[model samples]
Target: MFILVGITDLPWLQKLLFVLVLFFYILDVLGNIIIVSLVMRDISLHSPMYFLLANLSFVDICFSSITVPKMMVGFFIKNTITLQGCLAQMYFFHFLGCTEGILLAAMGYDRYVAICQPLRYGTLMRNTVCIQLVLASWLIGLTTSLVHAIMTSYLPFCNSNRIKHFFCDVKPVIKLACADIHLNEALLTNVLGFLSTSTFSLTIVSYVYIILKLMKIRSSQGRSKAFSTCSSHLTVVSLFYGTAMCTYLGPSSENSIEKDRIAAVLFTVITPAMNPVIYTLRNQEVKKSLKKLIKHEHL
Candidate 1:
């Protein structure tokens, strides 16, 4: 049971944030939509990496939708959200968040294959395997989210109803409970730690292998070409995991609420919008496809 007070204290500042966030939401949604369209419509982009990129685009769209719309509404209205609504939001936020983390690792592995084992990549990450991996990420995300939601639902809120943060996250929601929440907090810590650490570790390992393989290339142009494609993925991985580590991987109490809120905004709001930009800028195939898409629409 909680009402979201949101981030700013001043009404004017809240209005400003609303406008800014609304723009971000629009950009995030529109950008992901374009990415999905480009990946699907372009036959040249029909590969394991683009397939996963499309999946990631869909995930980002859903992930940002879970919070940004509601958060923007809070600015103009009374900022009241029922307990049930809050729980639902919490469920989806974590669901998509966890899925994105796992998906990043999957994408890293895809990259490793493309760079390190170009010949066998087709055999290794066939269409069936790619579909299975995407399905697995969703299934794992949903199951983990359900467990977290159920565990959090059992906590006694008593009369407490005010959530300090803009969204209905587990950490902020659990802070309002009158009953003991040590178990809940511990569970959160362990679950989040495992999720972030395991996926991030995989990403790191994939990249390490990719780099080592690239170093073995004697041709400077070959190394440059290979590294260019990987640079976008690496940049995205760093952005997503860096902000996530700041928000979830640390001692929660060590960071102030303001800092935590800022970190949340970075990953939740900004990162999704940035993904398409990163890919489109760095990826020649994507850019070419997007250009054709634009031309097609104009025609």
Candidate 2:
């Protein structure tokens, strides 16, 4: 039988990965903290769009925290993780992901309501409605992760003990199952695919309508001004969906390790770090409010 080995057996590469992972998470934390602080402190940002943006920033913070720190510690400490650690990591990892996915959809809907139904934006996304959406997103997050976790735990891991990457991603963990995980694989792929993709497609369609509406504006200045508002949101959406969908939809094999890792780094590491900067820097209203706040404080 061929010997099965993992990163624990390869010391040097793990150290390098550890440094890179820490750097990514540190950036994510710093950027997200700035966003949350700005949103909470600035009274002018108490609208639906900024509120959703704030919640999105919060989700990204929780999402990255789920995996990065443990990997950093694992690098200097024992490379091995306990079964309990594996399960906990898997739970929070997937849980935050599901929550973020739903929140992204909610964000898109918020944008859609703002752009397409401008007259009713306030009435449509009132405080009670926004709170309900946030609560529902959390509920969906826990429920989806619970299903995946219970399924993963019951699967027999008779032959191998090593997880492919730094964390216990569902796909990599399921691959190690000695039992036939084909059914579980199919269930996960189909359900999660529809969940993520349906929302993604809706987001794209919503933006298409938004751009169409912007083009109808009489003045070139009006059009440019309106389209500029969408620039950051569109960029964040593209980065997130592009990387995440590729990882979930693309085929995986031993030979695909490099590609998968690149996708993982983009989806889990880089994208979270980018969200806060994108929101704050691209938003004129936010920048104005922040500048005014700093000026007042200095005065």
Candidate 3:
């Protein structure tokens, strides 16, 4: 069993943190569910873009669910997790996270095709193609997460089993291992790093092409419309990759645990909660659909 340090030691602060985290977790789950439901029910939203977005919303639900509930439970009870439980948490955490990363990249590509190659949008981003992209993302995420979980499980944990973070994150859990962690660290740096960098690169490249296309449009309104279409996605991507890179790519050491925890909160807890707001407020189509749903329900 491993004892989690949790977010704070002060009883008063712990209460405050619990209330705040509960609020955000509820918001995250409900907002994502609403998005998923909207996309599934609304015929107008049955496009490649919305399909990818609904998938993203679903991933967000699972991603936040993996850690937040456990973290919340730690507030009132002893923050102890069993060996198997820790590994399972680590597995699903990375699985959903990696899947979301790749899904975002695919969303970027969908936007790129829709805006830049309008004529080919229907043909290029057909239903089968989008389904394949989602499936590929899930397969890749599963494979990578399995490797991490299996490798970390093999490490002997004869040392202190106290995790410095609120949950069983890869870095924090691996730090408790008695065995040589150089290979584990290398895998974290190389395998996970490649996944992050490659998916991030894909998103960047798609946006680059998208921006160039927008520049060619003579009408300011055309550019604005195009930019608006992708703004929500770009915002979400920035929030996710920014915190994720800080946590993973930054120097790992005892001194950085606090920083990692903060970064983890941003991506894992805050970002998911904010996604629906970002999409709904910025996206006219989504807002309209939401309003329609609300009005119809009242009748």
Candidate 4:
């Protein structure tokens, strides 16, 4: 069995964090569920962009769900997790995290098609194409995470089994292994770096094309209208990538564990909770659909 150090050692702080995190978890689940339901139920949202957004929301919920509730339970309990359980947590966390990264890139490409190649958007981002993109993302994520989990499971853990984080994240868990983990560390860095860098490059390249296309539009209104459609996606990408890079790609040290914990909260807990608000507030179509749903319920 492995013990989780959790977010804090303070009794008072644990209680406080438990309540705060629980509230956010509930909000995250509810908000994402609403987005998914809205996309499926509303005919107006039956488009490639909304289809991707709904999938992103679903990823956010699952990603956060994998870690947050377990962390919350640790706040008030012994915080012990078995070896198998720890491995499972680490696997799914990376699985969803990687999937979200790829999905964001795909979404960026979808926006690029919608904005830069509007004439061919229908042909490029057809429903079949969007479905394939999502499936590819999931498959890639699953394969990468499976390798990490299997490799880590082989490491000999003869030392202390206490993981100094709220959950069984790769870095913290690997720190407990008695065997030489240079290979493990290298794998973690290379695999995660490749996934993050490649997907991020795709997203950035798509946005670069989008921005250049927007620049050529003579009318300010037309440019703003085009940019508005992409703003929410950009915001979400920023939030996710910024914190994730810090946690997985930054220089590692004894002191860095605390920083990793903080970064983990931002990407896992905070980002998921914020996604629904960011999309709904910035997305006119989503807001319109929500309002119509409310008005219909009243009638």
Candidate 5:
């Protein structure tokens, strides 16, 4: 299917956007790679939280790769994707996006156990359990995305193949189908809603309890310390869920393409670029480990 991407008229605008997109893409890849490297090598960062965080960094790397590279190409070359290529992109986009959603929830739960159940944190979130949780997140992502991708890829595309928005978003892709897409719509709205909402709900519940537990700490220092551990996660969640919900949760209106595209950029591209920065800058332990890793590499 031939996909037209971005503002086509103004060459100047496209050039500017290409540079911006390339810059963000570079930042996302480099920052997440550093996080993964530091987390893996630093003995101090081998805990459950950092373990989940490393998985997140890896997810961010894959997630952005699914779309941003193609987007960068859109500015320079013929902005067309083959049917097979579009289907592949759609599948992996959902796969990695869903994985990141679940992993974020897992991270939230990790923080909950760390702060709320400090006494039993060891038994509750053992190495085996952490591995199980990580595996389950990927499994769920793969299963959910495979089903949706199969269903979507099979839909007859007799209509025009030009996708309205950039990339192979489910909604935009579905709109191109000439066949009655009620089922697709239902699945997109209800199934995706269920998947995203469920994980988002889990994250919310975890943080709610974490906040309540922090409130009980009598010492101001104690409360601050507990809150500090989770502040970065909360900020990341807000950025991710904010743009994601706006993009996916609502009704698909025709006029919302520009809005959707902008929101999509924030959700898919900018958020991933910012995640490593948010985690590393706000996290003292990560900073320390990063410094040590840099020094060791230099030596």
Candidate 6:
């Protein structure tokens, strides 16, 4: 019921980790709060993209809230979670991760409509459409992770209970299974891989056409501005999809534990932290709305 990784390190290092993580946790919480607040207050910001961003902020808050607090607490106490506790964490963690993936895909589709088909963008990404897309994202994510979680927990793990890593990832936990996890591996490959890769590919294709559309513009300012927006999405998507593909899609081997661990930090922790920053820094509308909100608050 104990974790042994780096526990022997100096007390100061543990303190540093706790302090650093606390700082980031605070920042992420505040950032997401401001994002949700700004998006809600501004009627002009009621578009589909920002609506999706708001949902992502909500997801970001939930996703990090699930793991970060536990991780930070584990640094001090027993750091040992019960078997059922482990299963619950795995279920929710996988669930949120899958949900976030679908939200990203939904965001890509939103962008495709906005950028590629400007004339009919509003009609295509109407309120009802947005609601349905968001609903579908939630359902898909929940269903996908539920299957994996059930499949994993139902299997017998008689060999070892000591998970080397911090979080309860399905593959790592299943790896400890004394029973055959061939089905888990197959599900991971066929279900998780197919869903994640397809979304990632769709995002890539969306951006490609957006870039081509930007190229056809005559004015340099118009082209630069269009490319700039695309660039921001590209940056965010690259950080997300790159880490994700490495973690889930790449070869499943013993060495992949650390790889996924690192990737988890990016996709689960840092990317959520970056979502607000992405909009505030890159998108002019979000910045203007934020400024207006602050001014009104002061008034």
**Per-residue lDDT over 74-169 for candidate 1, one digit per residue giving the tens place of the 0 to 100 score:** 887768888888889999999999999999999999999999998999899999999999999999899888887998888888756878788998
lDDT of each: 0.88, 0.77, 0.94, 0.93, 0.88, 0.80
TM-score of each: 0.97, 0.90, 0.99, 0.99, 0.97, 0.94
Q: Name every residue pair that clashes in candidate 2.
A: none
Whole-model lDDT, candidate 6?
A: 0.80
Selected candidate, larger TM-score, 1 vs 3:
3
Judged by lDDT, which candidate is best? Answer: 3
In the range 1-299, model 6's lDDT, one tens digit per residue, is: 42424222467777887887777778778999998988898899888988998898888898888888877776776577777888888888878877888888788877778778989988999999999988998898889989888898788777777675667877678888888888898898888899889888888888778778877888999887766665556677777778877887776777887677777767766887887788789888888998898888899
After the best TM-score superposition of candidate 1, give how far the Cα of residue 213 lies from its true spot, in angstroms. 1.1
Q: Which one wins by lDDT: 2 or 6?
A: 6
- In candidate 2, what residue range of length 10 has the lowest lDDT sum? 1-10
Residue-wise C-alpha lDDT for candidate 3, range 206-235, written one tens digit per residue: 999999999999999989999999999999
Q: How close is candidate 2 to the true structure, as a TM-score?
A: 0.90
Tens-digit lDDT string for candidate 5 (25-47): 89999999999999888899989
Model 4, span 1-299: residue lDDT tens: 99998888899999999889988899899999999999999999999999999999999999999999899989889899999999999999999999999999999999999998999999999989999999999999999999889999999899998899999988999899989888888999899999999999999999999999999999999999999999999999999999988888876677888899999988889899999999999999999999988898999
> Which pairs of residues collide in model 1?
none
Q: What are the C-alpha RMSDs, in order, of all predicted structures?
A: 1.3, 3.0, 0.7, 0.8, 1.2, 1.8
Candidate 5 Cα RMSD after full superposition onto the native fold (Å):
1.2
RMSD of 3: 0.7
lDDT, candidate 2, 1-299, per-residue tens: 11112335467987787778778788899878777777888888887777778888898998888766765666676546666677788888778887887777787788778777889988999988998888998888898888888888898777777667766777777788889987877767776787779878888888888888886789999877777677888888888888778776766567554466567767787889988778778889878877886798899
How big is the positional error of residue 203 in model 3, measured in Å on the Cα after superposition?
0.6
